[model samples]
Target: MKQGIHPDYHPVVFMDTTTGFKFLSGSTKSSQETVEWEDGNSYPLIRMEITSDSHPFYTGRQKFTQADGRVDRFNKKYGFTNKD
Candidate 1:
């Protein structure tokens, strides 16, 4: 461990711009923005374009590739029927 060589670790707020979700965590990153937390204290606010709250993978809203309808064309060409 070294002294005076590490970035300051402090509580920071990460805000999801799309979902308006806020998360509090410790970070060495700094921001010029600030926000009042629920604890009645202000913390550095970092605005993010994407987070778990709005991410497709995390929200289970992922958009699957259509494969250019190749599967359907193959099935039709082979006269194959899909079984439910």
Candidate 2:
């Protein structure tokens, strides 16, 4: 451990924009944006698109992807008929 060679580890907040949720954690990252936490202290706020709170997979909210169109397109390109 070298002195003055490591990044400053400080308490930070991660804010989920999609869910409007926030959690306090520690990191070496800093930000110009600040928010008042429930503890009554202001900390740097980091906004993220995906978090465990709002992620579809973790939340058990699955989204369906249409593969039928792609299969049809591939079959049409190769002149394969859906005879079945």
Candidate 3:
């Protein structure tokens, strides 16, 4: 642990731009914007385009494409039928 060698880790508010969700977390990143947290304290506000709150995967809103196996695709493409 060298002095003045590590970046400052402090509490910051991460905001999800899409959902307007905010959460307090420690980060090395800094921002000029600030926000008042629920704890009656002000912290740096970091705006994010996507977070767990709004991400499709995390929210279970992700759309999955139907996929066919290689064999099935080949058979469908060439009009091949299984003999067995």
Question: Which of the numbered candidates is closest to the native, going by highest lDDT?
Answer: 1
Best-first order by lDDT: 1, 2, 3
Per-residue lDDT of 1-84 in model 2, one digit per residue for the tens? 789999999999999998899999999999999999999999999999989997887999854343577888899999999687
Residue 33 shift from truth in candidate 3, angstroms:
0.6
- Candidate rank order under TM-score: 3, 1, 2
Candidate 2 lDDT for residue 8: 92
| Clash pairs (backbone) in predicted model 1 | none
TM-score, candidate number 2 = 0.70
Candidate 3 per-residue lDDT over residues 51-77, each given as its tens digit = 999777899885343234666888989
**Clashes in each model (backbone N, CA, C under 3 Å)?**
0, 0, 0
Q: What is the C-alpha RMSD of each candidate to the true structure, in Å?
A: 8.1, 5.4, 8.0
Better-scoring candidate (lDDT), 1 or 2: 1
Tens-place lDDT per residue, model 1, 8-62, is 8999999999889999999999899999999999999999989999888899985
Which ten contiguous residues of candidate 3 have the minimum total lDDT? 62-71
TM-score of each: 0.70, 0.70, 0.71
TM-score, prediction 3: 0.71
Q: Which wins on TM-score, candidate 1 or candidate 3?
A: 3
Q: What is the lDDT of candidate 2?
A: 0.90
